[model samples]
Target: MTETARDRLIVGLDLPTIADAEKIVSTLGNDVSFYKIGYQLVFAGGLEFARDLAKSGKNVFLDMKLLDIDNTVAKGVENIAKMGMSMLTLHAYPKAMKAAVEAAKGSDLCLLGVTVLTSMDEQDVIDAGYEYDPHTLVLRRAEQARAAGMGGIVCSAEESAAVRKIIGPDMALVTPGIRPAGADKGDQKRVMTPSEALKAGSSHLVVARPIVAAAEPLAAARAILAEMNGALAR
Candidate 1:
């Protein structure tokens, strides 16, 4: 599918307060249409904030990364489905994935399986007692997610091409750790440029600090969107 700039980008609202999030949205205005509300904002009672965004016609990607038993995760998915969210994320464990798929059966919610965080490298995977490297684990979990009927997988751009080859064309690949050229990598270990990630078959790019911490967040977002549009055109 052909994607517009807004369709391919997701801005992460990792701020601590709803007021801060409101300010950012007001600053960006219609330039941004998709927002990710993760644990920090949700823990700060940003559910109402998220609902307001949805009511204003913005897509909400709830990135809580649900990890729990099948029953609990199913219940959680059911609850979120009623919130008019566009997408929801959960760990790519088989039982959790199956439950999530079942819970979202009648809703418009897209269940995204988080394969591996962009912040973890091979050594970190080893330290976590995983026998495989980061790339290998991402592939394994992605396959599991697809098999279990997830809408997509959350992976880094570094592995997006390989994942695309594995999962085929229809599934979504939401990539994070998107750094512009010369931008700080922060705590992210597996990172890629916005164009690189798009070329590697990322369906959507999740960018936070680069845009949020910029001297001018609107300009930063516009530049990234232009970069994404360029990549899609190629």
Candidate 2:
């Protein structure tokens, strides 16, 4: 089967309003197949925007990173599955993760465990009272999700190589904290370029500012796609 572009990258809609998000969608169109709806835009446009995007043929990755009681999160997952979202993120709690996977069972939707926040560093985890190293934390979370029968995980591109090694070839690794070579890292600590991420076994790379904040958004998207294409060619 021909691979879909949506499998390659998930673009974060880091813009302020629905108008800005729609503008980016109009610019890239089918060049990008997956769009991430996180706290900001979901708060701005509500679930209707996500449903509209899915209706218009864009895969939605709902990045809520929900961490809550099993029943509440399971209901949320059920609602998202009914809405036809292809991917949803949940924090790595064994019961919650399993609940989410069970909620999505037999549906096309995928439940992804969030390993670690891209904005966090070693000190951040320590400050939060987690004694393990960030890498160890990510892997442990990934293993938890795997045992829960979830589809995959959300981790930084820096940890993609190690996560891939631990999870093996079949389990997907959707990595964020991806910056193109020479782009500003901004608040993110661990990051990788598109080519580097693909080479490191990331099933999909999530990029935000480098493309959205670019002076020319479409050009930026094309450039990242080119980088991904180059890596595939190699």
Candidate 3:
């Protein structure tokens, strides 16, 4: 099925408390249909909130980025699948991806392999003891994710085009660090505009601070959705 701008935009609920997250969701209303619950919100009773959002027909991307021993990772994925999570992320380690895939079988969960973070640059990767640069490593992880039967990839839009070639047309290519034109880049080093990210082959864009922290959260979300619509029109 074809996607709408609303479907492609995954707002990151990166708030410190459940009240803040709930307030944003209520404010955004039906204009925003998809949400990403990351570490910050997840710690503050976001899992139950995530399940609640799912019950209300909102798509939830549970961004846990799980990485652990094969048994541990598989066990977690098994439960996340039952939680009705639309999507879940795990570090793009071959073993973890493989285990997650096996655990998520028979469910609709899309297990995403998180590649190098957008906040990390070549220096940061090297500092972490990686030989390859950021781009190369992202593609390598994409390949590994595909080989392990992962349903999608989580990568910076900067590498979406190259990664798309590796994962092909069906797999989901979810990108973060999406800064709208003229917006603050903040700590994101590989940020791209929403239109640019979508045109670059990103299937979904995860936005947080721009909308969640905006003075008018709904307006900020509408503006982004407009931009995404414009891109999809082309």
If the candidates were sorted by their lDDT against the true structure, best first, what order would they fall in?
3, 1, 2
Considering TM-score, where higher is better, how would the candidates rank from best to worst? 3, 1, 2
TM-scores for all candidates: the values are: 0.98, 0.96, 0.99
Tens digit per residue, CA lDDT, model 2, 1-234: 114434687899987799999999998887899889999988998478899999888889988999899999989998999998988999988999988988898798988999999999999999999989899999999889888998888999888888888877887789899998888999999999898988888888898888888999889988898888888778
lDDT of 1 by residue, 93-178 (tens): 99999999999998989999998888898888899999999889999999999899899999999999999998889998999999
Lowest lDDT 10-mer window, candidate 2? 1-10
Clashing pairs in 3: none
Candidate 3 matches the true fold with a TM-score of 0.99
Candidates 1 and 2, the one with greater lDDT = 1
lDDT, each prediction: 0.92, 0.87, 0.95
TM-score of 2: 0.96
Give per-candidate clash totals.
Answer: 0, 0, 0
Give the distance in Å from residue 227's predicted Cα in candidate 2 to where it truly belongs: 0.5
